[model samples]
Target: MALDDSMDRDPIHGSDDNSPDRQGRSTFVAGERTGEIGVTLSGLRPPSRSIVEISPANIARRRLANWGAIQGERVNVTRRETFEYGFQAPRHLLIAHERGEREDGETLIEGLPRSTLREFNCKLSFVPAGHKFFGWQTPRVLTRVTYFYIDLQDRLFDLESGGARPTIGPRLFFFDQAVWDTALKLKAEVGNSDPGSRQYAEALGVVLVHELIRLERATTATARLIRGGLPVWQQKRVIEFIEEHLTEDISLAALAELAGLSLYHFARAFTQSFGVPPHHYHMARRIGRARNLLQAPTLSVTQIGVQVGFRETSSFTRAFRRFTGLTPTEYRRHRGG
Candidate 1:
């Protein structure tokens, strides 16, 4: 399940004002806003339009990962707003609402409702590949959401059966903690300076896809869990690899390839062997490294945090506290003093 290197070479086709897509009647202007790379969707064709377009004013941040792109936005409507929009790309779309709610609003796709009444945070809506949607919403204070656009054509989850690939049905106002958490992680990488963020984003996309597939199966029957752990040699190799790239954003797909296992099987086997998830193991190792670095009085706490893969001092502090029940400052004051 190693990621295809070709994804890195694929040209990202985004709309521009000067050169608009012939099929679509809209133009986009790409630029960086407040350190976030984004595209402003504008120039709707029809004369009568009140569509809720995906614009920079609505989008807070955006990140283009390998298999898909993630966008974080806040939709604010002072007055009642109704709109109809459609996406042309043949890809799956996931929208997670973090905040806000509207009891009167209704969003429809292909003549179906997308928004739910009395549901606010963590609500999700999914649009399958190649589907066109039309939505309408009532006036609300503001709604914060994260959008995950997945290009299913990339064949990131190829199965050996050679049968039809699993497809996610359009769902509205559902709750999936796993998908929500992964989307948040992807959103966090929007303007990350870490060199491994891309790998991390790609890994999250793979996990999200697998989770969606599992969700699809849950409707009919329980998902069968894969048995057993990795071989001793494979376990050792993956452990060594993690240690070597402790500072980098290690992808689960890459690790699965090293073990010659599917992502699902590899994750199960990894947890079985190590008594923790791969991400937790990596974080533990990072904190261990941070502990070792704390002893060196010359390195500041922030420097130690960055060295151990935490981009923010607050995040490093929180992780350090969670792992050792002490912040970096407190740990250094007691242990490294």
Candidate 2:
């Protein structure tokens, strides 16, 4: 059968053969030639130009395809800190051949320095299917690409209704494992015989976001060092400082000054009082806030770090692991929906 014929019977991209509408095709279009049907083709040349739409669904698809095409899993912001947005592209179907691959893999997609600690905003442009970003080939079957402009002009983009900021800002982000899993599930749902499967996925996404918000709160307190004393007054003051400058690094030194205590005196006193070091306390606060922002499936990890005062993803990871006993991915998996 010819490529176009096969496509007519079943689009190479969108519709799955096993779907309820098996006799028809979906939105996917691989390479359909005139009158071709399920014809096998390799080394196919992509069109000279490919345009991707910047819609939410399409953006989600594009990001997922880029990170999970070979891996089969979604991408997650793992260790966003000072240098770049650290992405955790989990091992999956396409690139399961390697170990520690997820730990070592990182792609600095885009950014510019805003100052010593912050970077400028970014406008994510959708690349055509099969195009390359870094070294990965974008999924070839996508119908549209979503465009997200990360406004880094202000690193602190809050979770409007949440207690803390969770995601990194100034860039588009994808979780290798999460994106892949979500997309695959979405695809599977679209192919499911049940009429409500797609609806379920949509519901699941909403639940996931809510769960993320709750988890962010639980984890944030770990980064802080709270103790006895002027409980109400101190809490108010600390909370005010933390909330006001979630993006700027919060240190024991700074906190002590705010509390009107010497570094040594504050360290010993605060530890005795809060049961943790000042630095640990501050970091806990930041991470907790970060966890909340991360709940937004849309924001990137590096953006989260920038929002939470992490100078780099590596530093964030180191600190996060020390406090939480798990990598960000592990935390997200256990905590995020």
As a TM-score, model 1 comes out at 0.44
lDDT tens readout by residue for model 1, 195-253:
88777777778788788887777743322433456678998999899899887777777
TM-score of 2: 0.30
Please provide TM-scores, in order, for all candidate models, with all chains considered together: 0.44, 0.30
Top lDDT model:
1
Q: What are the candidates' C-alpha RMSDs?
A: 19.0, 25.2
Q: Each model's C-alpha lDDT?
A: 0.60, 0.37
Give the poorly placed runs of model 2, Cα more than 4 Å off: 1-232
Please provide, for model 2 over 1-337, each residue's C-alpha lDDT reduced to its tens digit, 9 standing for 90 to 100.
Answer: 1111011221122322112222232111252211212321111232232221111222332233221112122322222211111111111011111111221112222242111111111112112122222211122222122221112122223336545434332222312343334334443333355666545755444433333344335434433333333245654686588678766645555766776654545455566666765555556777788778767767677777677767677766766676678766667778772
Q: How many backbone clashes does candidate 2 have?
A: 50
